[model samples]
Target: MLGAGSLRQQWPPAGKLHGATARGAGRGEPVVDRELSIERPDGSRIDVLLNITPLRDHAGGIAGAVNIVQDITARKRVEDELRASEQRFRTLANTVPVLIWQNDEDARNVFVNQYYLDFTGKTFEDVMGVRWHELVHPDDAPAYIADYMDAVRTRRPWRNLDRLLRRDGQWRWFDNYAQPLFAPDGSYAGHVGASLDITDAVLAEQALKETDRRKDEFLAVLAHELRNPLAPISNAVHLLRHPDGRRRADRLVEMLGRQVRQMIKLVDDLLEISRITRDKIELHRQPLLLADIVHGAVETSRPLIDQQHHHLEVRLPEEPLTLNADSVRLTQVLANLLNNAAKYTDQGGTIDLEARRDGTEVEIAVRDNGIGIPAGNLPAVFDMFTQAHRAAGRGQGGLGIGLAMVRSLVQMHGGTVEAKSAGAGSGSEFVVRLPLAEPPDEAHDGTAAGAGAAPLAGQRILVVDDNQDAADTLAMLLDADGAQARAVYDGPSALAALPALRPHTVLLDLGMPDMDGLEVARRIRADPAWSGVRIVALTGWGQESDRERTRGAGFDFHLTKPVDLTVLHAWLGTRH
Candidate 1:
């Protein structure tokens, strides 16, 4: 089967065959040639080897050679595919997103993927050997190593949730899984693993759980707070129903008023918090004397502080400090802080409101000698819905939004608020810092406002409401203040009396069956004779939208019900 002339001239190429054919020809046996390949028409190749022998006529003479070619293409193809598969595996490991690693039998890392190398800021040499633990968090390294060793010893699949230190020195969570590799004879060789980043998932799960817990707590606390006032109000109503109530009418009325005031406070807080959460509370900022602001806040909070019998001290910078701020809201802020101090302190405890100017800001601190905030809860004291949970039913507690609202409002004013406490029995302090501004203009006479409240005397006032008690009581109070007062139960009756009475002021209720306050105001304004009449909205609707609509309906002022008598009286005096 050989090409006779070509083999005779050169049995094998001198360059490749060297001395193979010559040796085989001398030995008179066959020489198995090395493997080779020939390219086919399809651009693929076939592996073949030449087996040559001496063609002797029974005399073993090297006259010519018998060349046999064997096709080893199938075996060669399988070997080449194995090598290619290994290359593909390495490429995939290097390109994947997750950090991947492989270790040798000695618990030494032999290889790490490109992701691991780049992300950990480690060179291949640094990651090799038993240096993998260096990449894990210091706190997690020991546990990871112990678990890895156990898995290797048992030759079993393993998994761990670990935190690893990144290149930037930040610790990141990872869910790592590994499987042991083995030699064909079933001896343990090494392990291969991958780590997936799970930081976001873990944090999300924790936050969701916390939110669910807080929601349940908030509902319970809200119900308790609402019921606190309801109980006193209900008791007051029962007391008023008794015949003897008339004899102690003044005391019963006082109790009833206090309970009503408490309920109104709760409702107002709810409305304010809702407005703040929706970014609905608009501030009207102006240059204001800090002393005037503090005085107004003191007036608002004085009733509670006196009720608690807390010794109060007010300290201010004598030079008349100032803040360009919303007087109403800032007054609210200071009052809230003062009110909190009175509520939390024991009867006869001492509380102080102190203010001073630091380098670039003014710091106001409300300090109290009472039950201190817990050390652990100080950080979360201003967190929404988080409470300084008091002892069993002893506290006239609030909805816990007071400080949270204070913080939010202060931050809105470009200020900061923080609380300081000495463990439990050492009392607490809340400090508020606001950036300083220039002094007031010369037109601002240092004489404070509200010092000259005009006496309500000889003024004709008409009180209108659906409730007989409210209308009658308001008229009585007005009459007691030396004013000419009349009470009417319905808007129709008030309208009927309007022409005859020709009152100077109309205190109208907005939620009547026959006619609302807005309609009443409109009808009054329609009469040119009543054009000069001052119309005020004295209603339960106190939302910003409610005020806007009232103004549009020609209401001179919007006063939410269970009105602050000081504010009401002052407003009425101005109108007169």
Candidate 2:
């Protein structure tokens, strides 16, 4: 046996000793050789060499030597676990619906999962570095880069909306929600984001809005077309019931007229509701006296008031209260309240109209001792086609649109209207509040107050309509009023005839197949040849907003179909 200190001092070098010991081990003997793989003493790998000998000695009595094992069990187990973890990460990335992506501060693609590759139809080699921007929409790439750089600079989450291009050359909206990975020192390492497609939701919302617009438009057109003929029918019936007709004929004509008026009112109500729903109502605001509005509304509703035998009281301030409002629409609002009061009240029921100033607003109240509204029906009363009482034969109830129109018109004037009642049969009161302009010191210019009756005399006018009867009848009416009237069907012909006829006023019809009335007006206005022509639009499209649009398109006036003779006369009198 060799002493340990002597063994160390007299020992051969490690490599040589290992080789000799491995060879000298006899057959079937266990031999161990130790050698250092690493140069550093503190950190080194031990290579454990095992020796294997044959059962029988070599032919010359020498034993055989074998390098049997190097024992790397711990290292192999660690490698297996790492491989399994990487595979699990890959599976997770592929399974999620969101796109998992990693990119550097420059927006260069560092790594993308199999899910991203499948969606983009691009290989890893094709999408790396600057090529990643090509997968984004052209219009969105610059913005995306700016936002990403900003996120990196601020060390914040990278969240934004962007359009990404798909393999089929279509673009989709994506919500990119990402967080910036930071080092221990708070330095930005890279960005990891989850991109979710939001295109479907956006498109669905747009589709819903578009469909609603179409529905409103359809309802408006249907109502207008149905009501236009009712006006003429009502006028004709009124004319028929004269002293010349017998009692039976007079009675029949009156019945027909009443029914026709009811139908017209219903259709008008529907059209008004549709226009309001589509955000198409436009109020033509001007300086108006509240007293005059109330007076006109009461006068217009006199027939109903008389029929109901209702007691009406009106209280107006001695001094004038001037407010900014659309007079015609305000009249309609007051008349609707008056009519409702007359309808719901008993024969001897009392109604009162009161007006006063509250701060900067003028408040008008219509109080009636009538059947009151139910609590639940109060809010729904303003909804279209939702009447408290749904009756087909009764004249007391109506298609529910007037109150809605009133609300819209009041809002347009920067005002509000409200209704209050204790309960049914107890009574109801409607209050309208309008912003009033302080009375100007100067005497009010009565020019707008007293518009002279329209005088359609000795003026040159042109009537352009596709319907022969409409054009001919209008021309006759104009001719009867002492104006020189001419007719043309379309834009080109109207333009061609304008040079010779030199008409001062042109009544243009819209919805023409050959160049619309808008185009005709444009051409006439654009022509240096005819600068003095006053263009008026006559069409079945009667929405208040539609009129404003036509007026903006250069038409001096807009009128719905089945034109009222009185209004026409008034408009003609005002023309330059």
Candidate 3:
């Protein structure tokens, strides 16, 4: 819009415009479409395209120059804006935590963000154009490619769980998802996708499934174990009722006792495992000689070894060793190992029990020439309710908690236990390592020192229970031991008989219909006359909390049933 004089003023004095125009006029040639910048009168600059041409006079000589200019400021501004927008998008895509990628219409990767590069540990050149799928695990690559191709062909969203190989050469699980992109014309474009690491979540889910499977298997095993003893117990009872039963009473009684003991053992194992898992089992630790403990364990496992007809050998170190541990629990640990060895071994197989001092710790090993554990199962041999030998049909009617109990009990004593095998049929060995203790000034070396104590002759004892059979049998047992023991069915009767009986000791059951043992204990404790009487809780509830409750109710002792006769007798000896 400016005049020629204003345009001429705007052109720089040293610029090429004047020379270019003169050259074009002299040669009769045209110079066209040269880009240049021009300033207006207000000092604002505009981008412009300039064209110059020559003008000729009538004699065909150069005369002057003609010039034209076109403004392109708006187009330049649009291009700048587009570049800035793309820069912003790249910044955001790279800064995000997840992998971000873009592909062209041909399904080739055109761009991948910083996160994707860092995750793959590869340069942009290495990951583009059909090379990205190589990072997927070999086992999962085929399926991943198939799914991606299907999504591309159908122009649909894609989702899959697969393993991807990391830069560290480890395969990890990834949950990949993608959404297909399209142009404004609705034509297909490649997809943008993200992958999330799901390895931990996947492992946790697998562990939960494995635990559920084991639980189901444990329940089935429990039913079978419980029924095995019941069948013989039932047959023994039936034979005892027959007319000719008296002739075979001793044998039938022995069978009945063995079956009853087996059932009791199963129940005890169940309760012990529950208590251990709940962190309720308490250890009564005391200094004891290793030899005494080994003797006790051998005594406990003798019946099983004899029944299996297995040859047993025992070895001990020459130097004396002691442990500050729970005697009963420690004994039970070794006994379980011995029983396991006996049960797994063929009849007349050789079993070895060895103990040695290893530095500040004592190592006890129980080994057998039996069907050894499979190599694959050694790690989980001590897992709860796991019977690695069950499939081989040598489980020997157990609920599969013995080894678990051994490990937990050992660990509770600040120790460790391990199972070793040279694969199945190569024999097996279980080693337990426990911290040693200095010999105490006075150590209890005897296993059953109080077991042969003086009888409760003339000792007045009272038994109270809701189960009539339990009460009667217990009272009979006490009377047979030379105590004047009487049975009462309930708390009320027990309270009524207390005045006349004036017993020295009362074996009370915590659970009764009309009045529970706690109230009775409270009442008995309140009366000064009964203060001298020793009250003991003879009930099925034996958790630490249960013991605490009994103590609060003023009972002298808590005993779980069916109680060990030696323990019961020891308590009675105190009253005597």
lDDT of each: 0.81, 0.74, 0.85
Candidate that would win on lDDT: 3
Tens-digit per-residue lDDT, 1-576, candidate 1: 254323444545467675343344455455546677888799998887766664655564447756677889998899999999989988999998899988887778888899998889988988778657777888888889898989988889999999988899989899999999988999888998899989999999999999898778888888888788789778777877888867877887788787778778878888888889988776655556788988999999999999999999999987767776777888899999899888878899999999998976889999999788888889888977777745423356677788888998898788999999996777889999987667534443223332223256657888888989998999888887667889997878988987777888888888888688889888888889888888877889987889888878887877778866656565665456
Better of 2 and 3 by lDDT: 3
Instruction: Compose the digit string of candidate 2's lDDT tens values, residues 380-474.
Output: 66654444533222225454566778778787788898988886767888899989976543433224433222235558999999887999999
TM-scores, in order shown? 0.64, 0.45, 0.68
Residue 137 local lDDT, model 2:
82
- Candidate 1: minimum summed lDDT over ten consecutive residues — where? 445-454
Ranking by lDDT: 3, 1, 2
Question: What are the clashing pairs of model 3?
Answer: none
TM-score of 1: 0.64
lDDT of 3: 0.85
Give model 2's clash tally: 2
**lDDT tens digits by residue: candidate 3, 1-576:** 222222233233246665343333345364444667789899999987777554556875546546667788998889889999999989988988767887665667888999888888899898788547787888889988888888888888999999877778888898988999988998887898888888999999999999999999999999999999899888888988999989999998898898998899899999999989987786766667899999999999999899989999999998889897888999999999999999899999999999999999999999999999999899999999999999888888888899999999999999999999998898999999999996432333222343233266678999999999999999999888778999998999999999999999999999998799999999999999999999999999976889999999999888899976667775666446
What's the lDDT for residue 221 in model 3? 95
**Leading candidate by TM-score:** 3
